[model samples]
Target chain A: MPLNDQLPALNREFIAHFGEMGSRWGINRTVGQIYALLFLSPKPLCADEIAESLEFSRSNVSMGLKELQAWRLVRLRHVPGDRREYFGAPDDVWEIFRVLAEERRRREVEPTLTMLRSALQETPATDDERHAQERMRQMHEFISRLMIWFDDVQKLAPETAVQLMSMGSMVTRVLEAKDRLTGRNTKKQSSPS
Target chain B: MPLNDQLPALNREFIAHFGEMGSRWGINRTVGQIYALLFLSPKPLCADEIAESLEFSRSNVSMGLKELQAWRLVRLRHVPGDRREYFGAPDDVWEIFRVLAEERRRREVEPTLTMLRSALQETPATDDERHAQERMRQMHEFISRLMIWFDDVQKLAPETAVQLMSMGSMVTRVLEAKDRLTGRNTKKQSSPS
Candidate 1:
């Protein structure tokens, strides 16, 4: 039942592509394939079942599952009579997206930001060093700006976030309207009697 | 001077860190170092200069430049009276960021979207297949929503986009205002009808 004999062609293809794409990203190929398998399985699968279904070694499957768990991409469960633990992906794709985004920001973006901050704190000994520090400041500012926006989006209720995203290009009109209102206020404050 | 005798310690540290970080990313260590060198150099540099300064082989330098060029992360120029092409990154970090975002979307996200589309087109033969298809549908919809928002952001003039991102969490207020207006209109249209 856990994708052993009749792993549909659709699921197989999906799993295979994810493996290939996973290597391109930070995740290893085997780990990516393992995640894809868990994601598509109709029920939580124990280690042995996953190993046999994907034709991977038991140790390999175990390692992949451990990696997936660290990514928060898979969850573990236990059956009533069975000693073995099973794993499955969260059912909600948006949850998966949120986890991936947050993890990447934490692991990759945060370190880069720290590096940039330390670089900026140093006093430049030359004009060229000054220029480099300036570039680092620009990079830092851009990432910080993005993080602030992302934080706001992260705070929104999932449905509201979806609604906001669905608004898409229409959000620009709202921006424009806000700008007009702010511009008029500034004009009124500056006008002479 | 092409940083032969007086490569700043600041530049050296920045280049080394970028190389380390770049390997974590898709780019190779040497290539990332090379790009960092070009990015911080006061002027465009020739292959020999890059190779000698970085202590990398001419061939490694050549390959790295080629990779950077493909990413549109570097530009080629000719110094007057010098036949060899010189390389430099865009002076504008925002331009570099925009190019990176666009290139990544085209290379990674677009292909995944296409794969999802093809998978969605296939008919399911069983309940299990239907469940797998449903998950795929959810994944596709989530990515599509993100893409729509990203596309609109990409279309904004760079300054405007910067301002919008700079607005940070304030953008949510706009979202709330838009929702209230739309909610009132719907109420009016349906009231006592």
Candidate 2:
């Protein structure tokens, strides 16, 4: 089937959006497009199939698939009587979200924390360095605490996670109400209970 | 103060990680470092201060500042008696989060939604397009509903928002449990709400 005839408007739109989002997330345009294809595909698609369907170079598809695997975004399947592998997205979007958050925290946040820890060890003789280190300490501690909570939230029931992610829009309002109700405007001192 | 003396380990780590994350998030290395600096600084820093302190090129600093302003990541301030403009980040991280979320939704999600809407207007007559469109409808509806929930989450109480963000690691475990308990294995029937 002709590519255009096979991919409806909705699919095209999805592909385009995913492509753009990929760029925002620091991935290449083609990487995003391939992911979108896998996401919308009902059955597993091989590298060649994806390349041919998307009209992208086989090497590009190969590279994108490798990165996707690194990110744990795609899974491989073997068709009976066939040696080649195919790819598919996980069944749950929440799972994808989990992988994304975890991967980012690991890749971006955790390493930074390590560096901050070592930096905090150095003594400061001057007020400027002292002040700067103070700021760094706050950030390190704050991010660390937040990471702990993320670990905890990940353990919550799936319904709870959905409720929380859905709470994205309502977050500020909730904070405001909590402020008025508790008279605590700064960070919460919620200790382990 | 000399840059070496002023840059704490934490700050250095932040700069390094932000530089790496910048590429992932579609921003430049220097730009991310600059934002990291702004984020931790108690007072606004001038272009010269930023340039001298971070050791980035003047032109790069200029471009980075322009981009930061466009993102609303920093605000301009003038000393009561001075003409030099200082740039500062919002004190509240939640505010920063709000801005980032809204901006990303606009830049990434909204455009995709627009594309999907336009694509949905076309009819899917063939099996391939029919399958593709069906998947597209599912994804489009999912993303749309998810964004609505995000808007709601944005308005959530600040403390609640922090509490939610703080969930960290627990986020994954809880959702997994919910998946098993509810037997919500399939994507078709699960409403994000």
Candidate 3:
């Protein structure tokens, strides 16, 4: 039974869009489609149901689920009386976001940070090396600062994080006011957009 | 002359690393190598120097520079009296981050937002459609909030932004204190991991 035959037009379109977007981001198309379908599913779906819904082969569905689990994008469950495992996306969108941000930091960012730290530790034997080392230091410092801030925000309850984002320039205003009092605004970092 | 022969060991290693990373991110290996070489040069470098240093063909270097310029990763320059064009990365790492962030948002994030908006606009004709629409609404809301925060922060002076990040959860504390005073701390968004 092809469950996709019963899918609402909107569901097909939504799943298709995510399939395209996911492929662009290095995830395979079938994996993206499976995740999108699972994401919008009103209840947990077993692998067979998943295959039928997306018209994916059983093996493909299994592999896609494995990839999604590796990305922490989906969770597994045992439906009490059923012998098959069921999979589902986290209910809260914020939770999905946290998993993605943290996972990407682990996969993509950690490698570069590791490379940078090692590069910075090497003693430069030439002027070119010295200049490159300076650039690396700046890169490492900025990324580390950004990551620390990320860790702090992720620790906050989602509501608190949302509130902070909505507060907008209120935080920057505080910095500006402190700068005014301390006369620390002399040097400006200008960037042409 | 093969300028790669003159490359400092550190510079060679740095260029090699970026080349590998770039390919993983969809940018080609040669383009990444070209950008890496230009980035480390003490002065703006012409296409010939770039080709020689990366051991890339003349056509490859030209194409890479064009791609880099499109990504806004490198700027085109004219040497004082030389007819040949030179290219260089922005001297400020912060500025490079800004360009990369903005470019990625334009290329990747905007399309998803557009799709979500369109999906939300369609009238739901089924229960499945209704559920899918609700999910799309949540996605749009969260992404819009994040983009707004990014815009607000990008408007700040680099030093101010650095100060804000280094403040390390101070902003979250303000929200926490407010929640405590308002008696609005009851509904927690629980997330696993």
Q: Top lDDT: which candidate number?
A: 1
Q: Chain B, TM-score, each prediction?
A: 0.83, 0.80, 0.82
lDDT of 3 by residue, A136-182 (tens): 88777878877876785665545644554444344454444445444
Per-model TM-score of chain A alone?
0.84, 0.82, 0.83
> Candidate 1: which stretches are off by over 4 Å?
A1-5, A158-170, A176-193, B1-6, B159-170, B176-193
Residue B43 displacement (Å), model 3: 1.7
Task: Return the TM-score for candidate 1, rounded to 2 decimals.
Answer: 0.87
Candidate 3 C-alpha error for residue A87, in Å: 1.3
Quote fnat for model 1.
Answer: 0.46
TM-score of each model, paired residue for residue: 0.87, 0.78, 0.83
The fnat scores of all predictions, in order, read 0.46, 0.43, 0.34
How would you encode candidate 1's per-residue C-alpha lDDT over A5-35 as one tens digit per residue? 5588898888888887888867888898899
- Write the residue-wise lDDT of candidate 2 on B68-131 in tens digits: 9988899999988888889998766556767877788888778777777776777877676677
Residue B152, model 3, lDDT: 60
Query: How many backbone overlaps does candidate 3 show?
Result: 0
Between prediction 1 and prediction 3, the one with superior lDDT is 1
